[model samples]
Target: MKILLDFVPLVLFFIAYKLYGIYAGTAVLMGATVVQMAIIYFMDKKLSAMHKATLALILIFGALTLILKDDRFIKWKPTVLYAAMAVALAVALWGFGKNFLKMMLGNQITLPENVWVRLNTIWVVYCLFMAAINGYVAAYYSTDAWASFKLWGYVFPLAFIIGQGFYVARHIVDDTDKPAEPPGDVQ
Candidate 1:
């Protein structure tokens, strides 16, 4: 259900672009994103920082696209968002000595500190690559081509996530296999 909600706005944007154009697609994307956020908030009673950032970007870039009658702003939105994420991850990992990715996932998955650092590095590199590729496509391609890329480009993140899953799988603790401690024993 959450995954479906996440894709709703992107799917709507693609369909609207195919049927109408960039402007209509932008408007639909904005509305769909707002609806998605509202649903998430109502269901979860809160929003993650990532969700808020994405919502803010869509609103800002979508409004610019609509008001200025220019699609470039909307086209650049993904690149900007990705770049910002890359920077944030880099800063948190290096400057602040924090592995945010690990901080978020550590409770659920147990891995060595080194593994977490490697994971954080992978995320930073992935985000930078995504941002660069998106900017390149948006700058070098036609609007129609860019629109197609926007839809098809989802493969990148999907592939990245699958790869990450594989990498993390090897490190996930199998608590079931551990010997049970004596009842009421403290350690």
Candidate 2:
């Protein structure tokens, strides 16, 4: 359900683009994003920082696209967003000596600190690569090509997630498989 909600705005945008054009698609995207945020707030009672950042970017770029009558603003949104994420992750990891990804998922998954660092590094690299690719495609390609890439580009994240799952799985401990220690052994 959460995954579907996350995708609602993108799906609507795609459909609107196919049926009408970029302007109509942009409008639909803005409206759908608002609806998505509202639903998330109602259900979760709070929004994550990532959600707020996404909402802000969507509104800002969507507004620029509509008001200025230039599709370039919208085209550049994804690149900006991906670049921002990469920078944030890099700063958090290297500058602050903190692994934000591990902080977020540490409770659910246990791994050595080195493994966590590796995972964070992988994400930083992935985000940077995604930003570069999006920028290149948006700048060099036609609008139709960019839109097609937008839809097909989902494969990258999907593949990354599957690979992440496999990587994390190798390090996860199955508590159920271990014999219980005596009460006095608790520490």
Top candidate on lDDT is 1
Task: Name model 1 segments beyond 4 Å from true.
Answer: 176-187
| lDDT (tens digit, per residue) of candidate 2 on 15-77 | 898899998999999999999999999998998777899899999999999999999999999
Task: Give me the displacement of residue 126 in model 1, in angstroms.
Answer: 0.7
Collision pairs in model 1 = none
What value of lDDT does candidate 1 attain over all alpha carbons?
A: 0.93
How many residue pairs of model 1 clash at the backbone?
A: 0
Tens-place lDDT per residue, model 1, 71-166, is 999999999999999999999999999988887778888987888999999999999999999999999999889988988888898899889999
| Pairs in steric clash, model 2 | none
lDDT of each: 0.93, 0.89
